[model samples]
Every structure is written in C-alpha cells, then in structure tokens.
Target: MFQSILSNLAIILLGHLLMSTLITYRERFSKHLLYIYTVVLFSTVSITMLYLPISFGDYRLDLSLIPLIFLALFRGWKITVPVLFIVSAWHFFMGSDETLSSIVFVLILPTIFTLLLYERKIPTNINLKILFIITACWIISDLPIILFIPNGMEIFKNTFLLRYISFLSVASIYCAFILIGYKNDRLKQRLEFLASHDPLTNLLNRNKFIEIVEVKMKESDTNHYIALLDIDHFKQLNDTHGHLTGDSVLKEISSIFNKYESDNLKVARYGGEEFIIYLKTVYDKQAVRTLEHIQNEIRTTPFHSNNGGSLHVTVSIGLAKFESGSRLYDVIHQADNHLYSAKNENRDQLVVSFD
Candidate 1:
C-alpha cells in the first residue's frame, strides 16, 4: 500500500511539473498548438492514473478526480470534454463490465461539480469549497464499488472509506498549493514585463531604455549615436483631425520605426509626439544612413485618419554622437539643442553636425 501510494504520487508530481513548465513558456507556442499540447498532457495523466489504482479488499482507488478537478477548473468545458472522452475511451478498452457507469460516476459527474465550484455559483469559504468538492467526488468514486462488487459495502466501510480521504485530501491540497505558486509566478512575470514596456506602442519605456543605454555604454566597443525626433506640426494636425486619428498616426509611426529595430538599434516613444532612436556603429556614415532611412520612411508613408482620408507627416531629427566617458544626459542635451534648431529652421530636416 505504501509503495502504491508512492507510485501514484510520483505520477501526479510529474504531471504537475510538465504543466508548470508549459505555462512558464506558453508564449513560445501558438494558441492552437498550446491547446493541443495541454489536451494531450492532461489526457495522458488521467489515463495513466487509471492503470495505477491502489488496491483495497475488492476495489482499486485511482486518483482520477485530482486531474479531472484541475482540468475542469482551469481549462473549462472545451478542453475538459475532450480529455474526458479520451480517458473514458481508454477506460472502456481496459475491459470493465461497469465501464459505462464508471465514466458517469468517476469522471464526468465529479468534473461538472468541480466546474460549478470554479464558477463560484455559491458563496463558500475556500476550505469548505475544497472540502465539499473533494468529499462529493470521493462519494461518487465509491458508487461503482458499492453497486458492482459483492460485499462491497462491508469492504468499503472496513478498508477503503477512511484511508481514501487522507490520501486524496492531502494530495488535492498539495496540488492546489502547486497551482497557486504557478499562478503567482506568472503574475510576477507579467508585472515585470508591464513595468518595462509602454502600454501604447509596446516599445521599451523611457526608464527601461535608459537602463539598457547605461549597460550598452559600459560594454559597447564601437561609436554610439542618439537620434531624437519630433513629428512636425503634430499639435496642429491633432487639432485639425480628431484624437483617434492622432492615435492612429502615432501607431503607424511606431510601426514604421519598429521595422528598423535590430541588435545594434533600438527605438522608444520618449513622450508625446517625440521618439528616441539609439544606434551602435563602427562608422559615422553608417549611423547617418540608418537615420536617413528612418526619416525618409516616415516622411513618405501616408498616415490614416478616422475620416478615411490619408495624411502626410514628417519628423525633424537631431543626431548626436556619444563621446567616451561623457554623461548620457549630456549627449541627450546636445541632441535636444540640435532638435530645437531643426524645429525652428525647417519642418523636415536631419541635423547631423554642429554646423
């Protein structure tokens, strides 16, 4: 009995590990592919549990409800139904005369009851919720034995009744704790990402950009440049068109800059109607060519308005080189000075030098 308990635990822990790993790296998969992998995983775990039931006098108790409750709670009907079908079909193949009824009591009914708990249809404390669901599923699990086996009631009352709860309750609570840990871990990752990224453009925010620049300044062996850009007559354009159109213009402009992003180049929406581009290069000429491409692309690409008409816009750019050992803000200040010059003198110009 101890060995059987150990074997069941090993299987359950392995299944949890696979699920946690998938959730951690879920972004690497397409949504459909992730769904397929999840179905296969839970179905495999449930089927494996059926084959490893811990034996009593006349009945074997498999930890089927653990996986069923988890799948129904987390995944919903779409995923649970398919998993149930697969598990039931495999149970039928195991050649029980009571297979059809076992499906009703063991897997399906418990899953539905657990899912109702998931929906929070009734208000209950968390402990009570867990207790109620586990107790109900436990009762359902005993139904097949009581109905189909001879002297089953005496066997169940004497051997299986008390021991089953201790195992299932401990295992269920342990699994719940693991899932709660996974949820918190994923939440922390999401918060970190949201902190570093701009909600509007999904680009690196100003502070994150600054952090990266500081790291790059310390490590970069080649020359570095900052290209500060502002949309020409942006306020007037916003006043002429609506804010929605203005938002569209900003989104389109951000999309244009996103195309030029690479290992050596990064871009950020610095503030309203302004952007910053950071570049690392061996040659000053290479830096200027990249800036020119970006400027020309923004100038020529037609932006869309809410009224379905197209609008043309241009960016005034100020390029400044980062001299070794100079403060980052000092370089940014020079770029701003040049930007002021570009804005004053012309609507669309790339100012690349002190001259």
Candidate 2:
C-alpha cells in the first residue's frame, strides 16, 4: 500500500509538471491551468491502477473524486458528468469486482447531482452542500461492497470512514490551488492589457501601434495606405474647458473610430490628440473616403459635457499610399506633413496623395 501510494504520488507530480509546461505555451492561462489539473488527475488514476492491489476481499479506495471536483471548479457540471463516467469505467477495469463496480457507479451519481449545482464560476467557499452530497454518493457507491463483506458494518466503520476523510482533504487542497491560479491569471491579463492600451481612451497606445504597424508593413503589399489624423485645436479645447473635458472628448472620438473602423483598418491613439489609421488596401481613394466619412460622423455628432453644455469637434486628416522602396517611417512622416497642411488649409478635411 505504501509503495502504491508513493508511485501514484510520483505519477501525479510528473503529470502536473508536463501539463504545466503545456499550459505555459497557451495564450490564456485559465483554460490552460484547468486542462493541466485534469491531465494530472487522470494520470494519477492510471498510475494507481498499475501499482495498487485490487483483490476480492480488499477494499480499494477510488481517487476519481479529485478530477470530478476539479472539473466542477473549472468547467462546471457538463464536464464533471463525463469525467465521472470515465472514472467509473477505469475503476471497473482495474480488477474491482461487480459489487465494487456497482458501488462506484452508485457513488458517481451523487457527484453528478452535486456537479449540477455548480455554476461556471468557482465558488468563493467550499460548498458544504455539494460536499455532503459527494460523501453520500461515495457511501452509496460502496454499498454493494459494504453489504457483501464478511464483517460488513465493521468494514464500513473503518475503511469507508478513512476513505471519506482522505477524499475531502484532497478536494479542499485542489480547490484552494485552483482559486489561487485563477486570481493570478486574472492579474496577469489585466497587466498585459494595460501595457498595450491607453487608459483614457482604451485604444491601442503608440508603442503597441508601432509594433503592429512594423509587422503589418513587413508583410503588406505595396498598395496599402497610411493616414494620420489630428483633432483640430485640441489644446484650445483643453484651454477653453478643463483637461477633464478634453479627455472626455478624446474618449468619445475613440468610440466613434472603434464603431466605424473595419478589421483591415488598424487605429491607434498615437500620442496626445493625434491618432493614426492604417488601411490595408491599394485604393488611395477608398482610404480617403473612409477618413472623410469618419470626419463627417464626428462633425454631425455633438459632444455633450457634464455641465449640460455641448461642443462640436473636427479632425484634419492626411493620407499617403505605401511606396515600394520607402520606409514605414517615411510614409508616416509624409502623412503627418499632409495632416499639418490640412490643419493650415481646411481644419476638417482629408488630403490624400500617392506621391
């Protein structure tokens, strides 16, 4: 029994390490961690079958409850039911007699019921109701063995009691681990998002925009167009109102851009009141038309202030198509120059040039 336990523990550790590595490779940590735990639990069951003694008179403890709890915590009831069924099959195949097999099946039924009560969210507390139901199921699943044993009541009093305690201890530990992992995963995601996005407008920041633009430019055909847009008299707006009002206006304009922009158009908050849009197309006229439409939309929409007042804002845009032998920076500078010219000439117009 001691050797069997050690071997199972070793298997669990090895499986955990392997699955953790696989999880690290995934983009999302929450799903990865759940999958890792499931793999480890299944590996533990397989290892136990190899090393553990299963005889007619011997009462073998089932470790399948761990996976059910994990499934419930991570994937909810839908996954737990199927996992329970698999565990039951594994138990029957590992030399468990018909009586023990029936008992295992019976015990798994309550787990199904317990799982049904699980919401997709991990419970803040270990659910006492579910725990009690699980205990009851385990007892019921062992009923056949309990009934047919030579000293049936004595076997239930000693063996089943110990098994129940062990199961609960393991489950509690698993739940704690899962919760910690969940919190850590959420924190990491939040940090990553903040690093990539502007806090005020919730749009991609200049740094992230440069990274994306570089990649796109390297892979892009020569026909793409790059546009720079500047909010006309943005500093004046801040001077007239407060910085807070200016921020609100920026946010409002960002929302409009997000709503109207297509997947092929990459928009970013490129420092202060300046924004950049990269349109992946050969048609310079289409890109100019798109910017004109955005300018028109902004002009028509009245930005309401907290003081029950309203203001109209306009944007000056300059666009240039990508040249075959030119650098990305060169394209951006050309667009910025044109934007400066637009601001000097017509504050709310778009100027498009391929040359």
Candidate 3:
C-alpha cells in the first residue's frame, strides 16, 4: 500500500554507490581532495534524503541514519564529524515543526549508537552486529514518534513493518558495499608494496632504490655518501649450510641495517649477499663511523641456519663520499674498487676511498 518510499529507496541505492566508489578509489585521490569529497558526499546525500522524506502513513521519515552510522563505523571522526555537522546544520535551519524530532531521530540517535560501539569488541559477525544496532536505533527513534505524535500507533500498524524491512536491507547492503571496497583497496596497496620491495628481506629492490637515489641526489645539496657491503665467503657459507640458512643470514643483516636507518640514510639490497647504503652527512668521519658501526654490528651479531645451527658471518664494506660534479655510477665504481681492495687484503674489514 505504501510504495511512496520508492524515491527514498532509490536515494539509498545512490548513496551506496557514491560511498562505495569513494572508499575503493580513495588511494588514488589526494588526502585533501578526498576530505572535501567525503564531506560533500555525505552532506549532499543526507540533506537530499531529509528533504524528500517518505510518508509514514501520517508522519514523515527519511533514511538518513544508515549512512550516518556507516560513516561513523568506518570513516571515523575526520570524515564523520564534518558530514554530521553539515547535515545537522542544514536540517536545523531548513526544517519545519518536527525539526527537533528530525535532529534526534535522523541525526543524533544513530550517531550515538555508532559512537558507543566504536572500537568496542562485540561477539557476533559484522553484518549481524550492524543489523542489531540498526534495529535498535529504528525502534528507539520510532517509539517517541509512535507515542507522542498523533495517530502514532495507527501509523506504526500501517507502515512500520514494510519500512523497517526496506531500511534494514539498505543497511545490510551498505555494509557489504563498504566491506568489499575496503578489501579491494587493501589488496591494491599490498600488490604495490610487493612490486617495489624484495620479499626475502622486505628491503627496497634494486630498481626502486635507483629511482629514489636519482631523485634525492638531484634535489638536495647535502653531502651524500655511498657504502657497498658484501658478505665474506657467502658462497662457501651457503655450500656448508643450505639455501634456507643463507636466506636467514640475509634477513638478519637486513634487520641490523634497519636498526641504523634514519631519514638521512637509505638502505637497499643491490643483489645477492650485497647491500648498498646511502646517507647525507656533513663530515666524512661521520660516514666512516656509521659504516664502521654497521660493520662491527654484523661481526658481533649471531647468524642462524634454517635448522637452528649457529654460524659465523662477516662483511667487507667499501665507502665513498659523493663528489658534487660526478655521476652516481662513478661513486659506485669507486666504492667497488675499495670493496675489492678490502677483500684482496683480508676479509671482514672496512675500506675508505682516498679521494
């Protein structure tokens, strides 16, 4: 009998599409752009729903609560607060006699429900949990309308069941929409990370390292130093142990590099058993001390094989400070020369360029 909510139902569907698209594609958009987009998004949908409300036999109601609740649960306050504020201000300013009731039911009640549930542990699956809260919100908001307003019981009898069913479906569909979009975004981020990082050590891969180094070198006037380190007798150690053990040793060395890494320094896996470090330092001595510290840490740290066997390990380091007018490869070649010199003389030593 009450097919009048068709427009509101359609509005809810549009809201679903709008919100889902934003959630899925937000990584592509800048932070400020997305911020404006969300505020406009929720405010527009909410205000439109409120203006074109459904006729509940005699009372008028809008399906704005679902989006408000969704925003609260997922987007948190940054997006939710401004959207809530914009919608609330519009309703309070442009509304009629039932404006107070509209604020309470359409805006405040659902938001409070979401706030109480935020980050608190609940025992049920997400869909059911959301359903329960939606139902509670609907019931609470309708009761005052059902009791205080005229013919409240008669309106409840005529339209409550159908309206409830429609809105409950909208809330569940909105939940699914958000979940699928969120999963897609996360998967995209993971794939991007894997593409640019070495899975074994989770360090920057060779190509990514070169990309960053080129940019950093061109942009800054700071003194830059490069150090190339290679494991001493890595092949022999792998032959004595196993490939798994070799992998463990590599990861352990990566962890030590990570410990010393800072904003001024970057580290990457150049190739097998070889790591490159780049840093900005005012004094050549600082570069020497840093490389020496890394060299010492490697010597002292225990290396383990796959079968839990303890093994000895050491690295030879070649350090060179970048000259302003020269190319990146020139410095790398110089570092390589020093590295071979260290290996030829003795293993487990640090060699600095005379230049």
* TM-score for each candidate, following the candidate numbering: 0.57, 0.75, 0.86
lDDT of 1: 0.81
Clashing pairs in 1: none
Best by TM-score: 3
Candidate numbers sorted by TM-score from highest down: 3, 2, 1
**lDDT (Cα atoms) of all candidates against the true structure:** 0.81, 0.69, 0.80
Q: Which scores greater on TM-score, model 1 or model 3?
A: 3
| Model 1 misplacement above 4 A | 1-53, 56-185
The local lDDT score (0 to 100) that residue 281 gets in candidate 2 is 65
RMSD, model 1, all Cα superposed?
9.7
Q: Against the true structure, whose lDDT is highest?
A: 1
On lDDT, the stronger of 1 and 2 is 1
- For 243-305, candidate 2 gives per-residue lDDT tens digits of 888999999999999986676788889889999888876666667778888999999889976
What total of clashing residue pairs does each candidate reach?
0, 1, 0
Model 3 per-residue lDDT tens digits across residues 257-337: 999888778899999999888888777888888888888888988888878778878999888877868688898889888
